[model samples]
Target: MSQKELTIGSMTVFVSQPYKVPQVTELIGRNEELELITAAWLAGPGQLPLAPLLLGEPGVGKNRVVHEVARRTGKDLFIYQGHEDVTAEDLACAVRFSDKSDRKMDYVVSPLVTAMIKGGICFIDEIAKIRPRALALLVSVLDERRYIDSTLLGERIVAHEGFRFVAATNTADLEGNAMPEFLRSRMRPVIPVGYPPREEIDSIVRSLYPRLNEHTGKLLDLFWLEWERNGQSTPPTPRDAIYVFNLALSLADFESLGGLRAMSADGEPFRVDQPGSASSLKESHLKRAMRELLPVSRENRP
Candidate 1:
């Protein structure tokens, strides 16, 4: 964990490290959502950037959309995971044992505060899970005031010129626990992220696992067949499709290693035989993986 000490008014604090970008594959789709978020962050003379709220299903790639935008815009990204127990102060700063020998305690800034201080993009995932009271703290930061007051540090931290904020919540969450109207009004242009088209989902799988290109079409067919057989109305999310393929690949590898076995009668330990070459993904592998990972309905089963 990288750390940097900075002076905030009279007190000095340690800032949290920016989120490390993962080895992301090509972003498949959501061109419109990407543009909306980018446009919302654009600030003109005498205008503040709009804070956009992303609404989507759990596995439909809401977070990925923000990550792609942040990467394309070349900005530091800070992620804050929102949950039921997150407090108002947790959004700003917290105290920790000092890493340095000179001090007894270290004031640690949260991702939200760090983003404001460093002019980065802050993405709060599942923002609806946060209690309305705790979320009230964001009112000032999301509005023209563009600052957060930390009661712990006794400092009013103003956002840098480039600071941007975006948050996402599952569609179910919004229906169950309504967001405060005050905060909702501040978060403009609510973007809905839906399941991608079949072609895009196929592209995503192929891009992420290039080695499966040969079997991609057949595997995808089986995936959709299973979906339809189960009488599913909507298409599977990209995550669901990807997991099936991932599991299929794992099954193929396991087969090549001489699938799991029991110990011999003499009590010899089980052993896995190393494969001389990579195994080709087969229909059986996909079917077995899907059955285990995404079981078919009992009535629909053959």
Candidate 2:
């Protein structure tokens, strides 16, 4: 994908493209959170859209929920990754060397500005990591003002009527580095995403890997057993559960390939007899995947 050129004012700027949504069966176990976000973005005659902040532990599907909402609403989704070093200007626009011979420099707009200009959904991931000084720019955008000023462009860019904003951060990040009071006050209806329950985890896994439907029950049992054996107080996150099953499937495939290679060396006709099939996933493979991917030491166990 290439940068899109648009005229902001007297200057021509390049806007960022929307994020391509990934292929997922569906968003499971997040209906309530989804409703909260959607409701917050609703505006009436005298009301402005609310900017919702999603807070959850890492891998608890904070971003997934937002992506699902964006997909359902049929909005162009623009994502901006927040870090400690991001400057206010970086959030609006930046200058780059131009590809065209006629222009010496190109003004490139950030994903946030692009969403604002195009009336799309802007999701800032790990927004708490950005310094308060840099985040100060969002004050007006989140309020009834609905505009952001770019010093470099010398333009006060107003957001489109359809422009919407949302942000997310890990629970740990908020505890360590709090957002400024002004920004926090403007971002309404803070949504907390907790870990999914056992049944929902099972459903999510089966939905993502339909090939393992036959063995999904036993695999889920093993997954819970591993979590208990590791002395984890919290249940397994969706991501942790998914990784275990994905790795188990990979392990089965590797072993099956090894067997086929040996048989071919002995002059046996090469054939895939249920090779890498879900039935080939044994308890040992699941255990090995858990040990490698979800290992918890005594010092780190909580």
Candidate 3:
């Protein structure tokens, strides 16, 4: 992954290509636009562990909050992205072969399986995407505080004392509405998240793209304002602001002309693509990008 640095006023921004899943705590602290999620666990009345279900709209940074919490707790994170095809083996281990028969009998551990054994944090993103069967694997693990024997592993594996689980979902659609009641019974303290306020979003943009000048900052503000006012296909999100900043950085030439004054090609801060080029991109595309980088729109306006 290559990292690009830029200066926005007094702040310096590091833009990395192939954006890494930033360490949880770093992402949580780097961006202010987020909320902590809590949920109930089915282990028992008082016995159930507090398995926080961080809920938010897509790109609203739910996973980031969980990641930070894991880091702050000094737990190793084992992440699993839930999808339709996810299977028990996907969560645990599956059989793999080796050319040499000497060490042939082996089972590879999935992140979830390893996390349970090591007593680390298991983060299942978009847990609802997983089918009932795939999710069934977790019922025992989350409640009994033990891992089941995988045919591949050939034995029941108990969890480490430090073992914990955190699942995230963007349940905005009816398709992935909620976890099954049985599973929901296991979750404790469900925390719902909404988009952040404008000022907070501005702070996040500044932190992520520190080198943006007042002019460039205002340029971002304009795009945000436009989206906020129109409520068009894409609403400005923290993600959107960061993306536009990165785009501005790529499109703007601050070198030869020197310093902040160099951003303008012909005396104007560079705009991404052409005026109407946004038409070529889907509203969902713009919204998705902005949700990650920009701020939510102002609420008081029409």
- The global C-alpha lDDT for each of the candidates, from Candidate 1 onward, is 0.88, 0.88, 0.58
Task: Estimate the lDDT of model 1.
Answer: 0.88
RMSD of each: 2.9, 3.8, 12.4
Question: Which runs in model 3 stand beyond 4 Å of their true positions?
Answer: 1-48, 99-101, 173-178, 233-235, 253-302
The TM-score of predicted model 1 comes to 0.92
Model 2: lDDT to the true structure: 0.88
Off by over 4 Å in 2: 1-3, 259-279, 299-302
Lowest lDDT sum, 10 consecutive residues, model 1, at 270-279
Give TM per candidate: 0.92, 0.91, 0.68
Task: Give the alpha carbon lDDT tens digit for every residue of 1-302 in model 2.
Answer: 24478898788899998997886688888999999999999987998899999999888899899999998899999999999999999999999898799989998899999999999999999999999999999999999899999998999999999999999999989985489999999887899999988888889999988887677788788888877987776778899888988888887876767655656656866555554654568889888998889758585666
lDDT of 1 at 29: 79
List model 1 lDDT by residue over 74-178, tens digit each.
999999999999999999999989767988898999999999999999999999999999999999999989999999999999999999999999999999547
Q: Of the pair 1 and 3, which is ahead by lDDT?
A: 1
lDDT of 3: 0.58
Better of 2 and 3 by lDDT: 2
